[model samples]
Target: MSEPYEYWLLDLDGTLVDVEWDYVRDVFDTVGDRLDRPFTDAEAETLWHGLTGSRNRQLDAWNVDPERFWTTFHDVEDPQTRAESTYLYDDAAFVAGLDEPVGLVTHCQSFLTEPILDHLDIRDWFDAVCCCTDETGWKPDPEPVEGVITDLDVETTEGTGVLAGDGACDVGAAWNAGLDAIHVDRHGPHQRGHCVRGDYRVDSFDELDLP
Candidate 1:
């Protein structure tokens, strides 16, 4: 960004860390088995990365019950196995050096997110962490972002803040909350199927043009 931001909020899953393909496949397989349908590799990738756009929309198109699929996914995933497979993106280490306050706003639930943070020894990096639940109203709704900023006690309205993430919902959440957004395009547009607009867009954290 050309201007300075007072604080930062970031998405956790695809933005900062990603589980290995083997783990990704295993989780999807379990979900598929429970749902009584098979998911091809392409389908799994699209859902896992939310490459096409809204995950619920994708699930709806597949005739899968969004609530049921999520319940099964969470139940099938082993926290320890997920932590073991998860690896932090090298570029994401940039967050550790940020002088401003940083918080996490992720759709990855707490049970899974906690272990990943603990395993990476990065739990202390964020002043606050908001794991979106049904009550928090998921991203694209400003509620969860509002919750995190409240937790961080960061200046609202007057302070410049930005949320960076690998998904369109992250950008939506930022914009909805009246904050700037950084679209971390981990997957190229070709793979993501469409580009997500943001105040700033970069392929890696190292590419952020912040002051």
Candidate 2:
């Protein structure tokens, strides 16, 4: 028998909103510039995505201080203003409008997350908004997800809820929290196929056949 989905947990970037990485890329460039060794656009793109874990290796090789580098990067990114650059998907709005109780579970910090939710006028749509902080941690770890589940007065029992996001960590977090996983393949099959091996897959929120 299948588990009943009593609640829905949603991811922000790439799942509900299309995040243009230009700003993020700029942050990467700024980091390089500050290091007095600038990176090419291509290099910035590679480091931004870090497909081969090369970013860390390069940082290590450069002897870049992780704390200093990331602090500078985050300062430049200014997710508060950057949130304005992202646009919401119609299907995401549809999902958010659903009558079911919904919780937002994201790796994004509350600084960015809160502004984005308010800008999109979906702040009140969620029963809970669980965001990562300096101490709260992020996805692929179950604490954030578990926090939202607790806020909703729901247990992290199997089939009790669903986690929908655009990355593998989302699914892994769902598994860790004992919730069903739904992978939103916004990048289509080729680019993101390997990242998703969840209970359900959908190219768009409209295609999601949730109950």
Top candidate (lDDT): 1
State how far residue 122 of model 2 sits from its true place (Å).
Answer: 1.4
- Candidate 2 lDDT over residue span 1-211, tens digit each: 1445778899887788865677766777777778676767655654444322334465676677667776777677776667777788877767755677899887666777877887778788889888765476677788888888889897655677899987777888889988889988766545432456789888876776444
lDDT of 1 by residue, 14-78 (tens): 99999899999998998999899989999999999999888889999999999999889889999
After superposition on all C-alphas, the RMSD of every candidate to the true structure, in Å, is: 1.3, 3.3
Please identify model 1 stretches exceeding 4 Å from their true place.
209-211
Query: Candidate 2: how large is its RMSD?
Result: 3.3
Error of 2 at 123 (Å): 0.5
Candidate 1 has its poorest 10 consecutive residues by lDDT at 202-211
lDDT of each: 0.91, 0.73
Estimate the TM-score for candidate 1: 0.96
Error of 2 at 65 (Å): 4.5
